[model samples]
Target: MCVGDGILPPGPLSGAVGGKVKFNTTLSPPTKPFLSVSWTFKGVNIITSTSVNVTSPGHTNRITLDRATGALELRSLVLGDSGEYSVSIIQDGGQQTQGNTTLNVYEDISGASITGSDDVLIEGQSSTNLTCDATGSISTREWMKDGQPLQPSDRVTFFENNRMVSISPVNISDNGQYLCQLSNPFSFAEASYGLAVNYGPGAVTILGPATATVDTLVVLYCSARTFSPAAFTWFFNGLQKDVDEAGYVIEKASYSHSGNYTCRAFNDVIDKHATASYSMQIKGRLAQRDTGSQDRGQQGHQMTPTPTTSRAPGQRAPDAPDTPTTSDAPGQSK
Candidate 1:
């Protein structure tokens, strides 16, 4: 018994251009020595004479097998080289064995970009479209928003070209960083576009601590409510921060991080800004007195060192003597 076309392996069809593609098949010679071996494509003889061989389209050489070993070798492939192929071997008493395999070619997608119907959208507005485009041999496209997959809906229309995915009727809900993916089984490429679907420049609010200690971890959070495509800009001490994400992280914090932290939310199309600011202070421990009279000595007189006094709140204590007094008892230089 021998394995035939009824038991050949399956292969992938899609591939990238200028990339390699291989077609393979396994053959078992029954319990008899083979008389001859040959390969074929589309039912046409690949070689002129009977010999163990492997043939590829558009190649000058026909890969041949060791007459005594019955081995196969194939090299140098192209797009048109993809197709159905078969191998047949002769066994004892004229019995024959054959098998078949399929090959697929693939290419890459490039030049991806983003565009829209209109540059902006107002509150309670109907809709528009956001398009992601590219050029290449991509078989299909995938749409994503903020890294999540988008499905088709009445508000959403997925348009596909040779290398583009356009979402029509875009609404405020569709404002975000959108990514388009083009792919074949062998290669994939992606591009990103940002949407600032503007509605009323939403209200911005600070979500965290109003005061913190020096050198401590602090997170100043800002949230824009009732806004579409919230554009956030964070400021440290009135300077814009370079952090790109929703929040910023500070390590080994110090008093230098303390300032009027501000977050401004806006949409370019709407030409509106909603800003929120938080007063942050990094407090430190109070300094201790070097001497008890150090504070009193600052008042511009020579203060006599006296015992520190404690008084109830709102109660007054006797003032300390300013300096040594000169006096005569009875008759003096009055």
Candidate 2:
């Protein structure tokens, strides 16, 4: 009743993330009369009798043949439902014949976002916590730093429950790239981020000339430790000046540009601004006049560069190395 070696089409082998699956089987008649058939996946019996179907991560399906329709059907497919499937059939008391097919599943994690804020601390002060949460069927969570498995340490803590991995108490020792992974028995997925903590402004550098030519454009830069893009304000000659976010630029800078300059920054979440000041002197016309008037000019023109060193309102200065200057002028420019 049967012809040459029987052939079976490859199984679906794959399923969408949180989606259903459908399967099918084909048969060729042999010389003997029609007999029954059975199906199995990875050696796990999916159906005891010919043509069984199932879902992901398991073997479950019923094989049914309609003599009138001459067709076979499978239903309710899932990711774990993917694998090599085998079928055996016996014809009219003759020997049995078997055929094999393979299946694959494709799925992705959902709802991605960074657990920590845009900014974090890295220095050995404290641990910063970050997490990744996603939802889907067959969910799993994995943690990473610099694209690698996050290491365990006193400086770094990773807490995993379901789809969340929390990295806490961030420290300088923890500086690096971070990410989290999620998956189900059928498929896998992930997300990532980089964490750099707050320190303070770095050495202050004055822009323009150390000694500017009178009538020349006077520009001053109050360089601080670089941080997340922050609002910056420049104070020139001890007075807040119209300037860009990071540095100050004066058109037709005159004697007014001479004196101390400072730069202050504020985080979006905070009410008060932090400042960094530097003593600046312009050697041209205005600053080169009489010593007495110059001293008076310098009095109001001098500003301090240190800003509050604490991130939290009432906390002590972060453990990172801050300049010897602890406190700065409170009324300084915001």
**Per-model TM against the reference:** 0.51, 0.43
User: lDDT tens digits, residues 77-134, model 2?
Assistant: 5556556766666656766767776655555667765666655453334455576776
Tens digits of lDDT, candidate 1, 1-334: 2233643455433334554444344545456556776666667756422533344454446355544334444444456656676667666678666776665665456787767655555645546566666675566778888989977776566554523444444456777887888777766788887776557666678877777777678776777764556678888777888864457666656878777878887766667778888887777756766776687667866667877888899666677566667888887775
List per-prediction Cα lDDT, in the order shown. 0.64, 0.57
Model 1 accuracy (lDDT, Cα):
0.64
What is the clash count for each candidate, in the order shown? 9, 43
Give every collision pair in model 1: 13-104, 15-105, 15-106, 15-107, 16-106, 16-107, 17-106, 17-107, 128-170
